[model samples]
Target chain A: MPSDGITAVKQLFTRLVYSLGRETATRELKWMKQALIASHSPTLAAMLQRRLSGEPLQYILGTTPFGPLDLLTRPPTLIPRPETEDWTLRLADMLTPTPVRPLTVLDLCTGTGCIPLLLCHLWPPGSTRAYGVDISQHAIRLAADNAARCNIPSFQPAPYSQNVFIPVLGDLRDPDVFKRLLPPFDIITANPPYIPKREYDKLPVSVKNYEDPAALLGDPPDSEEQDGLTFYRLISKILRQKGMLRDGSIVALEVGRAQADAVEGILQQSAGLRNTQVWKDPWNVKRVVLARA
Target chain B: MSSPEDIARARQLKELEPLHEAWSNWTHARQSLEETLPLMQDPDPTMRTLASEEFTSLTHTLSTHISTTFPSLLVPPSSTRDLHALLELKAGVGGSEAALFLLDLLRVYVRYAGSVGWRTSIIQSSETESGGMRDAILEIKGEGAYDALRWESGVHRVQRVPATESSGRTHTSTVAVIVLPLSEDAESMSGNDELFKMEDVKVEVMRARGAGGQHVNKTESAVRLTHTPTGITVSMQDERSQHQNKRRAFQVLRARLMDVKLSQDIANRRATRRNLVRTADRSEKIRTYNYAQDRVTDHRIGLSLMNLTSFLEGDGVQDFLDALRRNWQEEVMEDVVGESE
Candidate 1:
């Protein structure tokens, strides 16, 4: 009923609707209102105005729901998507129902510890252990905060420990990353940066501007051979060389729309992974590749 | 002929009989603790040490019995306690802001479900032009889903300035959350050919709206089902094929019908204890989210928490839930105690 406020609200809402669609815009506006109220800072309102001008809401809110965990979002880590949530929950359900032995899960390139936190939460506590490794210190720190906030037990190295969730900082590209890990893991999940540089550039301004490029484009594709497949190759090689994957263990990775075949190939050729399967997300797009080792 | 109240009291006493035996065990443990207490101060050093150890162990056992085993006996388990939940969120007052708040409420439940390992899915949703959900139905399936989410019914009001506001004045918006327990038998009933007669359902197909590229306008993929007798309608458009949409729509319809049947049963059971506590009412404003002060107050329980952001983010909502469950149990215990008197 306040005409000026209504007009302003409509304008801000319109911009958000344009960029994020109506649902997301509405959510972002609510978050902005909350952020404004929490900080009592006019700058927070200004940030919402910026969001209306095409800023990602996750960056503005500084947190996003990742599966069951509320993960802190900074510029350094990639935002967890709905696809990741679907696969992680699916994998958790797959593993938890008939776990014959004490299971161990290793999440590679764990952005905000979503996968591991969810895995630990779903799996029977004292029987299943999970470790999340990410190269970014900021991501690791955020993941640790999520683990503590979600009340998942932290990793304790004692034999057959009850603690289930652990976040470690290390590069997946490095062979030495496997050294500190307690492996022969029953399951490994990764949602590494799989977008090629060209595809990344074409992303919506909200993503291109706010999200880290390193979290989107792993390394510049050096030829037709190297496009977004570097992380998969590195992970498979490390697992194979270190003998880190237990027999009959699964390595599940979230892949881009058309990247599932390439990812499956990489895992099969390098890791000697067998029985590869591609899973479609809710959107019916090929999103995850699951391979047994 | 006995009144319903008399029957309920009889039932309560019958349930309490086993618990009363467990209660006697607690009395015995307390007696053991009292007997051991005097020996802790014995004159002989060896005797004193032995007595102290026995006293400590007996006290620990008594404390555990009192804390864990004793309080659990008070609340009688209801048939609906372990059922799955279907949570529907509808935008109430304050227009689009209410729709936005509905989305927030949905996220809170979804995230909370995820944290507890419950599986949740949006069975039906109608989004406003501005991206806010007009109404959404979420099915949360897992052990104790209904038990955890039943208190989440009723209206949730949010107080804060609208993001679209130029002159920054706080506004209040309400979103109604209706949580219905999904019967485990509903899954079997869905498969039963006679549960919902095909002749009773009016099926309609339409072109799906919003973001399927060329497929959105070209194909009549969305399916709507209206049960002619009950006037219950469900629409599903998210899936690609019309067949899939029809299946989903029918599934939701069956669940809704099941909910109605279950609610009637609940109403009957609840009629006996109507004076003990207010039944779940959707029109009631159960909770308030005051963002300006970073506070959330559950009006039903009279519990106020200062961490509104965390609560909305699905972190601190558990506090309110825990308190509500505890309070509900306490009320049940009081009702039982009153009936005994």
Candidate 2:
């Protein structure tokens, strides 16, 4: 029997609620129904049923809130975890009190425009301007869509509603990106892909099977076999360029929990780097490093 | 039916039971050798290497157990103190590697303290300001902390190509540790108060400067107090308020006084020809972490654990510390029994 859209959604929603429990299930079902209503498509019912069978709601709903902005959750762009959001908020707070005029911020490996869009919305105009750079075109498109979805006033064309929010499409490993967007930034932050490639394949279905493989597993091994710290080393190199950062500029990053000492060693070896301090996550894991360049 | 030797052996074994596990690793290799007796004549170099390695390990363990268990063993202090003791360096002479081995010793102690629910704060640290720490004074506070950390007073040497080295050649450095017991009360440990007097103390207030927030700056709150008579100094920069610093300084002064009095009491007892307990030597290389091989070996009781990375990351360290402590207690008891006999 071909069930009606309302009846079908209610049934699927109840099943989802049973599987994921009341809170998550209810939220996901609401998002599904809203998406269905907005599109006015019957296929949304089948998709909601697919989600009830344990498909991640981030993929099903097609978007997730990161900081103050909603980001498109799609292929080649990793879904922003709650820990990442917490770190983003923390970095935002750290960069807020700068006395310098027009605070410039850079978000490296910025997937789906999450960090930049959130900063653009949350930051006061004229005080701060943020740029997000990512290698994946798919990711950049998702990021662009996210910025549009968040209605980033700065990126809007003519009567520029806000001061500055630019999403530059560039590879972090490439020197060209730094040459082009080589503005003096007060803060450089990234939740760079840090999980070892060997460990990525063993991740649970929630991450491995669903998330973009490229976003999760980055560049291949170098001579030293240091894979995860690739993005960090590259960023450090680019930031060392003239006029890119002021003396004692903060470079904060979210890294793998156990890599604190190793990363500290890296910063120590960095030419212009001065210090590396570890900050614990709410779980007491050594999660963030605030390295200065 | 039990003979005198049987009874003595039984007592010795009982005394060693708590500690024997730390030194009994030879049994595993001996058992493996027995199993591989069929392959004793094997011509393969790989098999020969494996067998020889196991055999050498077993022999090393056997020799250590024999020396420690000997009835007339000297049983010197494992740490350095104000007291005098005979010194001997029988083995271990790898230059820079030996020094690096010493650095590993300090790291183990630090990690062990962390495992025991104690708060170890770096009160004062003079860093190489390049890659490694030069000398760091850690103030550990917890129940029984003084007694536990008392064993850690020693000279540590480290040998490694510092992470900042471009040439990737090893360098050697040495650090000395002095672990003073922050005794609960001076009168309890010394039974007297001749060594420390308030009149002998010289108090000084100075500005604290380090890596904290506005507390490190905008204040003249840091306190540095020195005992003029004893030449002993204690700094109280942990706290922000002047009153707190004074209180902390006084507490440290009291602890140092207690330590002095206790040492003096021990000296007096020895002069009267009384038995003094053996203390661990601080100069001894207690533990070594060979990063290249990913192995950590405690040289005292000859115990080696292969999982170096996980151990340093602060997991399952309590198990090792507990085993070592129990062994040390048993070793102490064995010496007492030998004396009584």
Candidate 3:
């Protein structure tokens, strides 16, 4: 029987081997040998202890790569993952400026504001107005900071648009959050917390200890009815209400393991979305589920 | 009368194939011209005309080979012969003028590489405020890149009236160009144990702390490899990824470590070093580019070439390279003959 109880990850190799490439593995280990010779700061033993104890390197370094941008990350907000980046790129590929209209995007639970910021960076500076909505102020602040840090250069022929990425702090549970959003979006991308309460305890210490629990857990905190699909159900309800999504626009969301079918069904039945599709990540697991309104 | 040791030593001695081919071609053409001399005296008018044409052509061929072809056994057999080259140029005397000349020297190399169909990339370049390069490393990757540019190691002095000067007084500025051989597979360089020890070097990276997977956001890694023993530090941040920076740093480190090792080896073998034409000293001025006389002169061989404009533009420089190479080979042959005596 698998010990960690995670459905997706193959436990064939140790987590450490799965985590870093051989070059980086050796590079990190090199500091140990280096410490013996030079007595440098962040010595081998200290780095090993920090890593072995399940602290994130990015959190320690305070910066992470999001597409072309370098984003500042903290423990309060979820760090951007490679899987998220993969699906985001796939999502970005689906969107293009109509001959007449500019592309507008709204990214929910935008930890590090990586999604909207990446879309902004990929798009012409004035071609996009991406809004990143997260309940946590820390997430919104970090996302806003990343927007300034990236400062993507715009090429000519792209008409100027105001504020490419706007970090909005709004709770998903509240009905009033939709009032803050700019309507008629071309794309609505979300990487919401989808892990059920029962599955949360089984997560690796690296994730459970370092990252925010609210960002990973699908259930609302301290609520009696703790369904894993709280955010997804709310997003569908929000979609059903007119003014958020325009014609031909989509709501593409990153999902947890084995939840793509469940999320797709919810979007189709409740949100009045048709042609819902499930996209697989590199690991061959369906990681993102999308539906067109 | 030749033993196995003698044969092996001869094989290891020099890269003389091109020189040997030139000599053989020159001698064969001379022999053919001698044969045609008698044919020119024949009674048949057509035969005489054909023979005279053949003699003239053969004489021209022999003269071209003598004047332009690399002299016999000039280039020493080197591990560098099969490798690529990293041309490092640093501005030496006369401040900004030296820096500008360095830029000109870099352009000349890039242009030369372009003409020869060799690929050149400016690996590390820092430009001066006066529209010049302070120091730069141009990577030339092609067959015979190192061999063609190996003799271009020492100081190249440029005599020109400064564009920045108020009065037109010729100022002597220098640009030091060092050509170092680089292996195609960078692993061979970093893997070598004799030149540098893995233990002596300390690789300083942003200590990648994390649970070791997708859970941590990967950084834009910057690597700095320090030789703890020599205090030689190579910091690389130009590459997008950390792994590439480390690999690039290791390659440069390998080249520099080899430089240090070879310098020590040459110093230890002072007796044997006297016979070689190329000195290890990079500080000494080897070539002088005189704008006043429109001449480019190689100080070592006492050879002067006219049309300095075309030379700086990378056309006429080949003539000097060929001449110096031939002269170097002649000197080695003399030393070898003297040893046999």
Best by DockQ: 3
Q: lDDT at A156 for candidate 1?
A: 79
Q: Lowest-scoring 10 consecutive residues by lDDT in candidate 3 chain B?
A: B208-217
Predicted structure with the largest TM-score when compared to the true one = 1
Tens-digit per-residue lDDT, B109-219, candidate 1: 999999999999987777786669989989898978988888998999999998877889999999998887675555331343534777887877553232221111122
Residues A56-126 of candidate 2: C-alpha lDDT, one tens digit per residue? 56676666656445567885478776456556666666666332455677888887766666666666655
Predictions' DockQ, in order: 0.02, 0.01, 0.07
Q: Classify candidate 3 by CAPRI docking class.
A: incorrect
Chain A TM-score of model 2 comes to: 0.83
Q: Once model 1 is optimally superposed onto the true structure by TM-score, how far is the C-alpha of residue A178 displaced, in angstroms? A: 0.7
lDDT of 3 at A5: 40
Model 1 bad stretches (over 4 Å)? A1-10, A18-23, A34-44, A97-100, A158-161, A221-226, B1-255, B259-341
- In order of appearance, the predictions have TM-scores of 0.54, 0.42, 0.50
lDDT of 3 by residue, A1-293 (tens): 13324332223113434566544444444333433355334434445546656677666555656555667888768988756766776776677654246787888898898888877776644567777889898897787777778874222233465336778888876878767665877789888888778877777776788888889888877766565778898889888887878788888898877788989988999998978989876445678898887
Query: Candidate 2, residue A189: CA error in Å?
Result: 1.2
TM-score of chain A of each: 0.87, 0.83, 0.82
The complex in candidate 2 yields a DockQ of: 0.01
Please provide the root mean square deviation of candidate 2 (C-alpha atoms, Å). Answer: 27.5
Q: Recovered native contacts in candidate 1, as a fraction?
A: 0.00
Please give, for residues A121-223, the per-residue lDDT of candidate 1 as tens digits: 7676577778898878888888888888877766576345354778888877677776677667888888887777766666766666766666777455554
Winner on TM-score between 1 and 2 is 1
User: Best-fitting candidate, measured by lDDT?
Assistant: 1
